[model samples]
Target: MKNIVAVNDKKQLASFIDFPHDLYKNDSNYVPELFIAQQDMLTPGKHPFHEHSTLQLFLAYEGDQIVGRIAAIQNNNHNKINKTTEGHFGFFDCINDQETAQLLVDAAAKWLKERNMTSMIGPVNFSTNDICALLIEGFDGPPVAMMPYNAPYYQQLLENTGLAKKVDLRAYKFIAGDYNDRSLKLTEAIRERLKRNNIIIRKINMNDFWNEVVKVREVYNGAWDHNTGFVPATDKEFHYLAKDLKMIVDPDFIYVAEQNGKMVGISLSIPDINQALIKIKRGRLLPFGIFKLLWYKRKIKGLRIMALGVLDGYRKMGIEACLYGLTIKTFQEKKYDYAEASWTLEHNTMVNSAIEQINGKLYRKYRIFEKSI
Candidate 1:
């Protein structure tokens, strides 16, 4: 008989995290997320997301065999910020069976309904701040670092379960020679023009990393406030995420725009560590996995231009173009094969135009699904 059980212990949690590894074992493009990282994110005390919110993981079983897993998330901050009582379903994985998918979705919907949530939206792991969405296109290759991936059958499973598209997020790819470098030539002129207004653009200061993080966090929270489903990152949450990114962050690829003494904009890009992570079997990082990670880290050939945001007052001052130019210049200097600027809202025409002007090809699309509870 098919049954759904809430994960209540370490063993079940491990099973929840590991189910996708088994489900995607035959898929060459699948890259397993690190088990330790997944554990920390799911655990209440380990991730700051749980401090102000709640999530319940559910596992599907047929007799003794595990068939699927999903997390029912109540993002208190999201509802409070957006003034909508919406819950999320994330970490979803299942077999090709529609029955299994329906059961899993039902469990999550029931949980949210019990909490008085009026509607549901996701594949959002917690929020747009984290990995979310279902990959609706571009299945031929693995995802870049910090992006989500899944089998194409997921689209049918979800839509059949009553989820409908809410919005689409896009990822743009830039091959080394294919991208226009006009921004590089225009960056200095733009920088000089901004200097007349006492605004300057410079690389992130590694010497005073924490202080810089605080400034960048302010810009981050302020810059993306108008985005759909955006909830400002808490101080703890920002620090927690920044701490992890610090391990792989490159100063050359991170820049900030400042007016006199205050930061007004920020752009960050990280080397595509998924290239290294794909070789780490089952996402375990010990017993030869560590050696593989260290060996492969040096050979990564791509970057994920994960974030580029400018405060409202600072927009159209060429800060965006300058940041992109600086990053693309560095990417060329290092001889990286490609880079991806990702997860842009499909309706965000201004940002989309900026990316397109530089030859960023919309190579992938991910969708957020919504259903009324």
Candidate 2:
């Protein structure tokens, strides 16, 4: 007999969080999210996402053993702003059985339908603001911070269950030494051109972070407004993220392009914190977890180019090249091995080529799925 239970207690929720560790035990690419972080995110009153949104976690069991888990999320802000009745299913994991996978997806779909949701999409854990896609390619290595990963078979399970490809997300890697130099030279000229236009690229003001963040928020919201499925990060989401990134943000790699002192473009690369989170033991951050995190901060090798965007009028003025140049400069000057400019929309050829111009290798790929209910 099979039973699907909604996680309501601490023990069950812990089991739900730990299920992936068991499912991917033999998989080298599988990285465990910090147990404490997952707990806080899933726990009400802990993560601000829960303040406006709702999520229900379900675990499938055959007798006393666990087979699968899923999170059915209703992002009220998403629907209210976009005026679309779409719900999301995230943290989906299941054994290699059709019945088990179906049960999990059905529970999610049914729950949203009950709430009057007309359509469904995602493996979006919280929102696109968080990691929302499934790894469909480049499964050979572990993912960096804020990226999602899953078994290849999971793709088959999702499609067989009626989910369809919404879009493909890409991650590009750059080996600092072996990288191409064409863009490196071009970046200099690009800076020269931008300088002639009163546009200058410089590091973020860490001392005035609060004031800087407001300016950044303005550019972040305006620059990517045209991208598909992009939702402005709520103040809560931004702060929650900033708090985590504070430990790893290097001002040199966090740059903004300004023209006459007005913000025009922004780029930020964070030390791949996943290196430390992988050791956090199921996302727990108590006892020795915080210690491990602090210890590994300086030793982090890779960087994730988390955000880089230029507004409409400023495109093609070398803002992108300057951003990449600064990152590469930091990598070489600091002697870091490689960096990843990731989770870009597959269709975003401009930015992809911008990174590629600097000899960035297209390493990993992630995908988002959507289906009509």
Candidate 3:
């Protein structure tokens, strides 16, 4: 018989975080998440997310052996802003067993129901602003930084638990030196026209990082307000995320659009630190693991075009193409192998078309599943 237990203490939390390492130990494509980061993210008062939301971790076990894990999340900001009593489930991992999957799902559902939620939607760790979704396609390789990965059978297991597809998110791949340079060729002309409107595209000012982060955060929150499951991140949440990204960010890959000194658009790409993290066994970064990370980071040759956004009124002014063109130009100069622009909503045709214009091939697809309680 399987038993589901709430993770309430440090020991149980440690088990919950470490379970996936053992579950995917033999899988070549599995990249372990950092243990310390996982600890910080789950602990109350550590992550800014806990300031306004609540999450309960649950572990499924057969006697004393752990078999699966999940987090039932209640995001108050999302509910308050969207006017829906929907809950989310995330950080899911399990053996390829339908019974174990159901146990975990049931546990999460029960927790949500207790909170009076009418429906549940996830694989979303907390919200769309965080690492979310399940890898339903493109399992041939490891995930990039801040992306999710799962075994192929995960789809079947989740479906068996009565979850239906809520939406599909897309990831497009661009092989450096191979993508169409139409944007690059046209960027100069677009900039000239934008100058007529007093708009200019420029790289982020790293000298004043905090102030720059504030500007970009404004654009991010304003630009993505209409997206599926979108929620405006609090200042704490945005800065918390920015602090982490600062470590792996390439300044040249971050661009902003300004209209007479007012921020209107922003784009950011980060080095794929997962390439380094993959070599750090079990995602430890102390003792010998730190050396592995420092050594491997220099050799990382891939990038993830993590964010690109323009304020609603600023859209269609070629700012998008300029940001992408500048990024691609740097990618070629650095001689990186590939870059992935990812997790775009499947129904977002305008953004998808822009990526496609640069010859970004659709390669990976992720899905968020939902079910009524």
lDDT of 1 by residue, 286-352 (tens): 8889899889999989999999999987888888888888898899999999999997999999999
* Ten contiguous residues minimizing lDDT sum, candidate 1: 313-322
Cα lDDT of model 2 by residue, 239-292, tens digit: 787777776788888999999989999998988887877776655677888898
How does model 3 score by TM-score? 0.99
| RMSD in order of candidates | 0.7, 1.7, 0.8
What is the C-alpha local distance difference test score of candidate 3? 0.94
lDDT of each: 0.94, 0.86, 0.94
Error (Å) of candidate 3 at residue 328 is 0.7
Of 2 and 3, the candidate ranking higher by lDDT: 3
Candidate 2 structure, TM-score to reference: 0.95
Off by over 4 Å in 2: none
Clashing pairs for predicted structure model 3, backbone only: none
